[model samples]
Target: MATADTMLQTALREPARRLTLDLRAVTFFDSAAIHAVVRVAERFPGTLAVLPSRQVRRVLEISGLASQDWFDPS
Candidate 1:
């Protein structure tokens, strides 16, 4: 959670820069991590796509957030 928060903080520090979360190597995607991603996306006002691994895609589907525009289930 802290790491995700730090990601958000970094994004906040550079609002003009685009942010992309590369979760292609992440084998675990918990609710807390999802929440952190959500919080970060909420603050950013544009398309915030995340490159998700299969494991992350499963979690996102289970969380019912798979359909969200920010997540790429590739």
Candidate 2:
């Protein structure tokens, strides 16, 4: 499970844009992780493409962060 701190740290260095996450590598994501993603979206410019697992999507949905465009095929 990658910690939010670690994830945020990586995001900081990477150019802001679309972020495709392979949730299979992420075994856990607590509120802190969710908060970090929100923060990144707010601070960065452009969409954060989250390729989360079904479990991760569940978490995002329950957290009110999931939207129709989140996984849109288009």
Which residue pairs of candidate 1 clash?
Answer: none
Per-model TM against the reference:
0.78, 0.72
Report the C-alpha lDDT of model 1 over 1-74, residue by residue, as the tens digit: 54666665676676554578888988876767888788767866475878889988888888888888887776
> Number of clashing residue pairs in every model?
0, 0
| Candidate 2 lDDT, 1-74, residue by residue in tens | 35787877788778855765555555567888887777666656456566776667778888877773443212
TM-score computed on alpha carbons, candidate 1: 0.78
CA-lDDT, candidates in order: 0.76, 0.67
Q: Which stretches of candidate 1 lie over 4 Å from their true place?
A: none
lDDT of 2: 0.67
